[model samples]
Target: MSTQPEHGADKRRSTSAMAPRNLARLCLTYALAGLAGYLATLIGMPLPWMLGPFFFLTAASVLGYISPIVPMGRELGQVAIGLAVGMRFTPAVLLATATLVPHMLVSTLYVIAYTFVAALLIKPLARIDSVSAFFATAAGGVADMASVSKEYGGDPGSVAIVHAMRVALVVAVVPFLVFFLGDHGTAPASTEVGATNYLSLIIALGLAYLVAVALKPTPLPNPWLVGPILTGMVLGVSEILVVQVPSFLIIVAQIMLGTWLGSQFKRSLLVRLPRVTISAMVAASFMIVCAGMGAFVLSYFGQMPYATSFLALAPAAVTEMVLTAKVMNLDAEIVTAFHVMRIAVVSSTVLLVFKLYMRMKGSEIGPGIQ
Candidate 1:
């Protein structure tokens, strides 16, 4: 009848053996992230909540000041961003976005094609295998590409690093580039950030989280984000629940995303493969330039702003790009739509491309891939 020992064991298990230490680390990480976000805002930085924490933590992680990480931060951020963006899809906005489907499709293909070329560039520059290079160069989600690379016998670590470097470069550069171009004026936001209805927000987030849980067994790429977005779109378009996520919440989400992203920077990875990292940086930079060119073409044809077009076409760094669009007063809905479409197309076709290319090579999967 004595349950003291059993309860004590349960208490220990709940601690996770180092709960205090882990909690302290997490608190410190978040403190740094919060300070960085605030400082960014004070300094008039573009996408400050994201870029500030991202750059700050990135340097900290690299320089051994801290190894920043936030568990479940990415998913939480995605949900918040997804809901925020989903509210932008008014009937008029949706109608306008629909008109540019063809242009977006072309841009998506252009991105994929250029990424292939980037992969080719990586091969010689980094001396990495084809599978790793290809997956790394592709502009899909980093985790998604890395997983596929593993399946295709690619170096997942390399894929992750290259993708990380590419993401960091694009995020660090694109917003500033657009800012310097004078396109980042105080443009209209997607939705008005009205007085947040705390009750409504809690309900909405709860539903979105439930939706994510339900969709977890499915093949959705980013259910946490996608689920909330879809839900928000329905509610927004219907005008049934016109609630706003507090600015603080959105900033918190950005901090979460930035923290997780910054933590992905492995100093060891860079040290171990300096040439490969450099090659990835080069390829990423090249892709960014190509995206700029594509933006001009798309802007001309689509009759959209050059900045909007550019963000829509930018490779990798989807959330950051979309956030940039929002911050710059660009067409965030269009940007979000374009990124979603590209992810869908890439997720569906990338594996097929790799498989077919392997078949075309005949007999073997290529030493680069192997």
Candidate 2:
């Protein structure tokens, strides 16, 4: 009894001692991310704050220069970005986007079709389970798909890596295409940070937070982002006097998101499944090509800009695509709406389809494929 009591005390003391160190490490990580953002901004890189920290931290994490932590800030960053994007949805913008609904629906279907084809390709080539391939190619958030992968007896790590690669490829490739190939060569109109009202900002954020909390238990994908965007849209469309979010806050949001994304990559994870890695890269490339083709068709038929259509159809996360649209001065509202529909359709239907496939296939491959 005496020995057990002493050990408990020692454990408590160790836990207490580790808390401050962990906090300090987290602070240091944010500091480094901010510094990286600053350097990228100086060089005039596109979406400098975001891309900078993303590339820097990804390099650091892969090289063992930084230890990864749970990305607590990413949720807050998402809310911030969502709020900003929502503010762009004035009545005029909403009306303009209404006509694109049919196009959006068609593009979303294209996404689902391509994802299924990609999963089929991945299943045979990568030799992963059908469920894992389905989740990996579903084009939802990496974290979301990875969580669901466990339920279907899929490889969570493989799903995560494939989704990560898909996002990284889209983020890397789309920006260059927009800047070089698209007609827009200049940045969007800047938000006047000086016009910000602190009280309104606080109220908007508070409402966003409450909505996020309420939506937390729901099955909607990325509720944190969706809730805030909905709240902000109501405020914006109603002509309510919410202040513009300060530029620095937006930058901070970008930094947090980029840092979080970067930290997800671990060398060990990649090293374990070399074939999976290569297959994922190939699948990501194919998805991009599909998105490009779909975008081209939509743009030609809908008389929309190619860049806008591409961002709308690209199978990346909603937040990432929205951020890219903001940087490129495309129609962020349209992009957000399209991605929201895509995520909803994919998240709601993929599991059912997987289950049906299992039922039809019999016991040949119930769980993990190989």
Structural similarity to truth (TM-score) of each candidate: 0.88, 0.86
Cα lDDT of model 1 by residue, 278-338, tens digit? 8889999999999999999999999988998899999977788877886676788888888
The prediction achieving the highest TM-score against the true structure is: 1
Who wins the lDDT comparison? Answer: 1
| Least well predicted 10-residue stretch by lDDT in candidate 2 | 1-10
lDDT of 1 at 18: 44
Model 1 Cα shift for residue 133 (angstroms): 1.7
- Model 1 RMSD to the real structure? 6.9
| lDDT of all predictions | 0.78, 0.76
Local distance difference test, candidate 2: 0.76
lDDT of 2 by residue, 120-199 (tens): 88887788887788888887766667767776577887887788788877776776677676556243343633578888
